[model samples]
Target chain A: MIKADYNVFDTTHDTQYIYRKLLDCMARPGKIQSIQSVTRKLNDFPDGLSTLLAIALTLVDREVSYHLISDQSNRVHNYLKWKTFSEQASIENTDYLFINQNLGEDKIYQLMSLVKKGTLEDPHQSATIILHVDELSIDQNKRQAFHLSGPGINGVTTCYVKGLPIAWIKQRQIINSEYPIGVDFILTTTAGEIMAIPRTTVIERKEE
Target chain B: MGYVAVTGGRTAIENANKLVHSYRLKDAERAIEVKEIESQMRLLVDRVMGEGGLYAPEYAALALKQTEGDVHEAAFLLRAYRSTLPRNHYSMITDPGEMRGIRRISSSFKDIPGGQVLGPTYDYTHRLLNFDLRNESGAVEQFLEDFALELDTEMDTPSFPKVMDLLREQGLVANRKIDEVEPFDITREKLAFPAPRSARLQLLSRGETGAMTALAYSSMRGYGAVHPTIGELRVGYSEVHIPYPFADEEEDSIYIGELKLTEVETVNSFTQNNQGDVEFMLGYGLTFGQNEVKAIAMAILERSLETQGQSPTQDEEFVLLHIDSVEAQGFVSHLKLPHYITFQSMLDRIRQAQKESKVETGSKG
Candidate 1:
């Protein structure tokens, strides 16, 4: 029933705005950007899936593939296909991956490794992971800190993220060690905030 | 130079727009209707439609009228207008061979199955202008009278078959293996290097005529390694078909109305295939409306770029990036925008360099 109810609102204007926000998030690795969607009540959707869905509705199309890692429900997959017309791909071949919740360290590592790392000739062919988390905060005591330095960052900037296992970052580092051939991440929260970490970013865990 | 920057910016902008409007309506001899432009200035409308990548004749006419016959600006206006439209169902694959061909020619072989029909082209016309239309009244009436008489007899025309089918039958042309993979839509995603054939064709279809012509000409003038002959050039209407939505129904597809298209197939010299067998490859170009020159040139450039020879025109990035009417026009027009800050920075840097040189000279003395 929810699959049939999924809608794309303010199709052009909202998509353009969301697209710019997504671009800005990727351009500035540690900066948090907000996405405004017609579906304002993010709590109605299962686990922070609204933020991922909002971005996916704007960006995904039939040309690319979409994979849902944390979502076991066919409803979400069918809803994504119906709304965006994007192909439902397996984890290995997906252009965009929607992770509805934080996974265990082992599973995270396995998923990261399994995801497509683009070839050097076509670096943008790599997968983009949209990860939904419980909270995203900069408080060092409450969240794990990340030292980010990349093409987008003016210099090194430290940012903290919550609701994800600390070991996941280490696995991400291992997966993204090869330059120009790695997956990117769009860390999202139920509050409609997102921070992008492209493969170019040099990530270091401040406290293990 | 010392004058203070003027205020009332919004008022100034409004007045500047009024000035342009006044110039546009300077004489007010006659009001030009969109229908008049669509009918009378047809070639210009076709060019706009091709470059704009939209096949709406009325809108193309309106865009041409709005831009005062500036081809690039008219196309830009049409493209901007197209953004406001909603995405409907994508039309099914179009077969140009099934077109009701008004004009069909094959330069590869002169005495083929069907003789060439040079329909409504100025290819053999004299370059001198006919001055009789300068003060001619009832021009439209005379034209309609002349053409309407022939329409009755011309209605029973036959469909022309593709010349490439002969080559395919003889195994002379390279065999095309149909790939079931869905083609990438360039408008949806950013174009990557070593682009797919679909994206390449789409870009070339919407490319500006003059730019594509220049690149193709360069390739022909010994800059590249493709000597192309127009194997088949067609100007006709291709029917658009879309699949019917109901799953249980027996009737599978619906016929959307026909779209006028110009299709060109160019035959290049023999080349070794991947398996080291020699075969003559083909280049193809198709665009909206009767735009044969652009399609022909586009076919050559498509082949040239595919070969990836040691020339600027053969470079996919060079040809694809530069040929877009919108992008090229936008970039060239951006120079007219106020660049005081950037200019001031450049001037400061130059003056500083000059002062440093002067100081060095004084110290040396």
Candidate 2:
């Protein structure tokens, strides 16, 4: 049950606009879009959480299920269920998995592996993973720089994403190698910039 | 001048809307009430409700009036309105067998336990328009009086047993194992390919009537292999049930009024189940109101698409994606929206191609 104060503010217009941004990000992988936080008054969450919460409100509903991997308390889970009306699913069975920056390399690896790789017949049955981070940059000097080349990217797009485990880029490659059966990702930063990396995108780790 | 600006068309847009309203109300006749439209143009109302994916007659009628009888526009308005509403609770699985039958018939059997009740239908009626109704003032009152008199004697007895139960008893129909799987709501999420049966049914139920009929006709006309016999066609009101709030298994569900639904259970050719036993497959369809044609078409199309065959009707994406009136209307009507940049680019490309061709021809000359 959701608290009375937990409100999905202006679900018709704001939520739809946020979804459009999410769709655009998904369609053009590596393209960052801003999702304005409308329900910031509800909870004074951590830095990058407002956007994640907004996304939960926009996309998650009772028909769908989500699993939260956050450093925040179980309040986030209750808030999501209450506001979005989405069912709380296990890590293996979730449609959307929210992964905050707190998870270590080992936990990320284990969770990524456990994430549902939908069957060949129904590739869309796979989970969409939303990772919340501090910032996203395209600076070459960054340690977490990635070279992406795939369906959405023109030729090769190199970018830096903060708040993921250093080994995550390689881990994503391994998980998504089978084509179509892998989980898609939307990485949101504290600055309100969100970038998507679908399963079709090939993510290569760029050494500093 | 055609204004394209950051701040323009405020007054022009306002007048343009006024212009539309003026056009809609141009007739100097008496103002048409929504209730009149709801009762008189019931088929149209039903079509709009089905396509709109909402079952509100008053709303559908108002939408029709607002859109000036444009089916797609009316449906779009209803759909847009529906998007603003919050979902309270999902109705429990409704059994069509429990429908208080107004009109019930089965094409497969000569006679059933519940005899055919061909209640007020146009099936046998001549297509000629009644010119007498044009000047008729007390037509509505007289019709109601006659209907009231008829209903006094002709009210159907309780418990209209379903025709399918007879087949089930004889083991002709496929054994239906009751599963507790929740039906997917197609309105909430984007429909993915190889969609579940529940999602497919939901989409088909809300699909445009004409689109569904055309597709079903194509299948019958040899595009796909499905020749269905309507096991039962029922049009009546069914009670909508929702789980009692915070109630346990012992608690009876809550009844949230009744909705008029058209239901069809089509029996297609027998096919072997996974166990290699011959069992007749049933295609089911139910939609809002007295929409028999669409319901029948939907039942046939539902069966045709269930096999997931390569044929046009069998292909889920081709049938399901195209049948949605709102989606079809939006995609088709969006062309009317300003595409200035795209048009300019296309013009540039055409001119560029022409220039290149001319250059080649000039050099050859």
Candidate 3:
């Protein structure tokens, strides 16, 4: 008898709304979407955990395994396990990896390298890395800007981010060199904003 | 004249829906109750349960009444309802040999264990309709009272051994090692060509009964080479259990409930094994509720798919893709939807071709 708390988020309607937002972002890479309205209704979650929890509650279930990085106290991990009934797996075998932006660049690189890239036969088996970042904006004033051109974009679209490491993008490029066999990235902010960079998208750094 | 798109289509659709409701209530007789349909139309409810792939009898009855007794539409409703649900647990593997059978029979042997108890079947009944059912309120109670006296209440219910087991013991049936691999769930994953046996079985078990019967009939009528004898057909209740989530021991499980099922095992022609020993092949089918025809047809088509042949029934993709009632009915019924633009485009192409042909004929003359 697994008891789950439903007060913070509705299992049906909330998850459905979050899933639709995530799907829209995934389809149009570099497109920013906000779920602040939904997350604002939630309370008592630590800084940045509410947005990540919203995503986890939408995608994570008993069918998949997840790994949470940068949670030294395992609070998020335990809550996720209790709420979603999902098992905690190692980085390599996990289907979803939730990473905090505070994690060092070196650790992020190591984790990204070890994550599953799937196989030629079943590319959908690949892992999805959800990274908590500071901010995502369409304005070019942010610290780093990426010009994305892919199946989802019309031709090229530039998206700016504040706290994501440039090295991680390079590592993603290397891992995704072989088409259709790579991890997808969903960058979420503390303010409940999200933008996706699917493996099909080609990202290039825009010079200031 | 060019096809003109209408503006009041929404009002028309709304009125059409209202008209459907009106038609359902036009009869002066009382509206049929869901419970009555479930209990009185047992076989029809069973057919919907099998085809809809949902075992909720009350919900199946509701779908039947809502669809005005259209089995296809009722099944579509149930399947659509099933999609909104979340899958929480996978049940433990069940064995049909443990079923408490209400009806059991075997065509391969005249006298078998359990002695062919034909419980609540119309097989031996005449096809003629009796007028007595028009006013059957008193007859129902009287018949039940009379029938109860004839039943042997003192005897304990007997369990029977599987007919296939006897053949296996005699080395007459081919040896098949138990496949312990986790069965593929067709609902979770999109089906691809050259599907695994688990996916094939999942699709066939919930397939449309009339379509499956027709395909099986085609095979029997010389379209294919599979003709099988019923090894055993059993309609019974089977228990379902799920692993307890918080249990410390692996053996700990919770008994969820029981389901009424129809299981069929068919014995086919002999085939040589890798070592050149000849043995009879087998086809198996199982579905929710007591749907004997669907179960038998499923067994025939299951075996037909295994054989290498040019027949449509032997084509896995052809048979499996077309057998889904919801998919088949949806595709066919979608033709009734507006296709004005497409038809207009086709008409334009034909008119241009006619003009070009006329110019060519005039120039040649």
Mind giving the per-residue lDDT tens digits that candidate 1 earns over A120-172?
A: 88788889988887767666676677889989999999888877777657777
Docking class of 2: incorrect
Error of 3 at B290 (Å): 0.7
- How much RMSD separates candidate 1 from the native structure? 6.9
Clashes of each: 0, 0, 0
Off by over 4 Å in 2: A1-208, B1-10, B154-157, B175-179, B248-250, B273-277, B308-310
Q: What is the lDDT of residue B345 in candidate 3?
A: 90
Please identify model 3 stretches exceeding 4 Å from their true place: A1-7, A27-45, A72-78, A118-123, A135-162, A177-181, A199-208, B1-8, B138-158, B352-365
| lDDT, candidate 2, A39-136, per-residue tens | 45334677577778778877788667888877774888777756665668998999998877577788888988888889888888888888887678
Sort by TM-score, top down from the best? 3, 1, 2
Interface RMSD over true interface Cα atoms for each candidate: 4.0, 3.3, 1.6
Score candidate 3 by DockQ.
Answer: 0.34
Question: Which is the winner by DockQ between candidate 2 and candidate 3?
Answer: 3
What's the lDDT for residue A101 in model 3?
50
In model 2, state the lDDT of residue B319.
94
TM-score of chain B alone in model 2: 0.93
Give the distance in Å from residue B356's predicted Cα in candidate 2 to where it truly belongs. 2.4
